[model samples]
Target chain A: MAKGIISWIDRRFPLTAIIKHELTEYPTPRNLSYWWNFGFLAGFVLVLQILTGIFLAMHYKPDASMAFDSLQTIMRDVNYGWLLRYLHSTGASAFFIVIYVHMARTLYYGSYRAPRELLWWTGQVLLLSIMASAFMGYLLPWGQMSYWGAGVITNLFGATPFIGEAVVLWLRGDFAVGDATLTRFFALHYLFPFLVAGMVVIHLVSLHTVKSSNPSGINLEDKDNIPFHPYYTSKDGFGLGVYLIIFCWFVFFAPNTFIEAVNNNPANPLVTPPHIVPEWYFLPFYAILRSIPDLLGGVVAMVMSLLLFAVLPFADRSTIPGGARYRPIYRVTFFLFIADIFVLGYLGAQAPTGYVVPMGQVATFLYFATFFILPIVSKREDKWLRARLPQELLAQFDRTNALAKGQNKGDAP
Target chain B: MSDSKSMDKPLDCPERRNFLEKATAVVGGVGVAGASWPFINSMNPSADVLENAISEVDLKVIEVGQSQTVSWEGKPVFVVHRTPAQIAAMQASKGGPDPQEDTARTQQPEWLVVVGLCTHLGCVPTRDNEGWLCPCHGSRYDNSGRILHGPAPANLPVPPYKIVSSETIIIGVA
Candidate 1:
């Protein structure tokens, strides 16, 4: 019987216990919003990307000479290869969309606050890993954009103080972006997703340790919590159904939405396209890089923009509960930051020209300003809002704070 | 309880034990790094890539006022047989972004050789009447391959070359 097998494994390993504890009976906030669905959706996309990527790799050649041709062959000759490729490409974009929403949800809900810092950091690491994987995968097709984009990004290392040139050369495995670079990128692209999957496990572990933060932004009591199996499993399943409909539409109908037209042509280093743009996901950071006049300064600024996420827990030193749930000013600030990011992404797609330069400068300033503004606003808002809070809510807040303070003694709130 | 308490106590040579532990960890760390070096260094330019370092160009075939594109280590090398007017125009103006004299950018004023890729983002600049214009970004380069104006932080790089004979020039060898 299934029970006999499970018990046999459970005696040696914590298999049944793990499933029961971590999946079926795990405590989760009952008031979790649709935004909570994105984490599950991100995990789903990760698996989708891995599966589609494995299938595509079977027919794809990594050599610079044959890379483009191999892709064509996959499209023309291999059965369901186009579907696999499209799904993988579409899944890459979907993964980013899901992660961004998940992160936005985190920021809005103050899920990155104390006791969940490791979870946020793990998510950040996952983002970096996925970005690296996507960058490497972009070069696999050996298209003009792939070649030039890789050249441009790899050249960013050339902005380093001393060992810049050497690092660039080492990265390319040649004087220029060539066969060695393509092969190596292919190898790493295949590698990074597995590493990401491993990190995803860590991310989950961190998440479960602190438990999920709800939109209400309060640590709900045991009575307010619900078991994961029937509640969240069903909810996540419904979210997955919705996500798949959108994903499959892109994969089948608008497969090339994420892919570039210039990427169709084989990589010719001798000719640069009229305009070389990065994939849509990288546009905001690309805009930030272009905003700075100096190469080294731009590279540093771009890198800092990403690293700024890691410091959010420390930066917003507000004792405010319910992140943006009650804070009107903070909500507006959050929306403005999101809009600024959109503007930056749009600007990044355009050529750096007359008005674009000035506009980009303004947007870049706003992008960085949001982070600097957050702490001051959060602290002041906390003071302003605390006076107006109901006595019961204030007492609940105090109790939660006490629990957070006492967490070092290995007690869960 | 007594036996367990005694077991928890320090050994006779605790310092030596600690030293052994530290030494083993250090050795293991070094071993891991040593094992990783080959895989890490394998990504560096290999022998076959290094072998194709030099590219020989037949300068005799290229006519005056004409720019010939030749492959050098898989990068486009622009060999422009600069006209007298072109050389004069380049020598007269100071390059923007990176201020360099025309003479510094070329081995000979009449025979200008530089990597064809744009200094901004490695896009090949198309030849123009006045200079080269990078289509990707709008980086302009003078006839001598010095950056005129635009986002390119530096001039089109001048690859190392030796003028072996009147007919041939060897690129990638000084």
Candidate 2:
């Protein structure tokens, strides 16, 4: 009887066919490393965030007067509320960790090359949407940092050339951050995650269209490919197990690691905190904004810093398939770029005084310089690497080079 | 017979079709914008918020050289009773970074009023012996709230306020 019912449903819908094609029998490169697990991990964190957030939102208030006390009620009064809140908070940090690692793996493997540009672009949009969600979410707690951070960030709109003050007033729903701003942000904060989920669907569709890029960066034959079900599902399950252990440790033991201490105090518009700092994730961009002298210029610089990531597909002109693996110069620059980001983040957290000022300016310069330098060096390095290729490898190198340029899509056995 | 056949024929008018297509797009665009207008305008400061914009502070209690903070439009307004020496110094020194006369920053020499938030990133500046110093980025302001040095491009903003009686000063009137 169950078999007959399944067949009836299968006739109406392609349910079984879709399950076989996408889940059970989907093909993936056999050589994929543990780095490939981050995409799965990011999806896991998103669901964790949504589930925890839904439960937390049930007991929390979004008003300026009640928000802080509501959170206190959740911590002290509600059963298991603290666990849900901590899990949600830590899940945000975990989400970024997973995404950054996923992006780094992509960069390292040259996964954002031709034929996958749309996939990379979709991922960029997802990053921006996630950032918007995080920014709005931070304000829901109605803490001192939340208040001032909203004030400062909304003031960024005041840098607009003509209608600056009006834009700022509209954004805050008043002359300063207050009740109206809080309610609207709370609504948007809840809304953005679903938008992010939709974007993730688009991202996956783009991904499945081009398929996964392996560490070697070469499009392999079907013989080298493995079904995603038994092979990758098991590997991903193991990775998720390891990630959860670390995530839960932070959630239970050190929940406040990602939360600012000043946020414990209720938001007071009259008093801005002595030393105001944004959440750790925003520090690098905040540092970039601070480094510039002009308000409008700083806002522009900070925005460009993010939008520039989209240019990576074009900036990297190297015909080589495997990124950094076969190229020495690209590898060195990649590490330098990471170090520069660390410096910027560190400076962003400190008072903008003494050595921090000059250091920040220098680091900000280096950040942009890294992008500008890539295109020039990549073309030269490709030529240099080609000249050094052995006779036997030259014909094979030429074939792969054309493939990397996206001349063909046939990855058949 | 030819006239009857011509009457039955369909007219292939490219210009008319093109105009209709453009007209439909424009009307649809206007409808979408009209539908979005309310949602966009909903974010602006509401009637209730605008109603409470005006705040009154009794200036009778504040002593010379002391400053009082009053909330207006949800922002801190610094009301300082300037000392004789402080007024003299500001009058003599040319206001910097953003140059304005000490007379311009104040309505009366003794009563100096400016918004407490930093002109740069909006952090509230703390009062000091010389002037108010912004703690976040180290932007210094003189007694008249003129920008002295640091990343701040302008002086502390003067809000629209009025002194109604000798003792009563109302903020946010303008």
Shift of residue A64 alpha carbon in model 2, Å: 0.7
Complex DockQ, candidate 2: 0.85
Off by over 4 Å in 1: B1-31
Q: TM-score for the second chain in candidate 1?
A: 0.90
Candidate 1: clashing pairs of residues: none
Q: Kindly list the per-residue Cα lDDT of model 1 for residues B4-122, writing each as its tens digit.
A: 87877766578989999999999999999999999889989999999878999999889999999999888899999999998888889887878888988877788999999887767
For model 2, what is the error of residue A238's alpha carbon versus the real structure, in angstroms, after optimal superposition? 0.4
Clashing residue pairs for model 2: none
- What CAPRI class is candidate 1? medium
- Compared with the true structure, the alpha-carbon lDDT of candidate 1 equals 0.89
lDDT of 2 by residue, A115-153 (tens): 688898999999999999989999988899999999999
lDDT of each: 0.89, 0.90
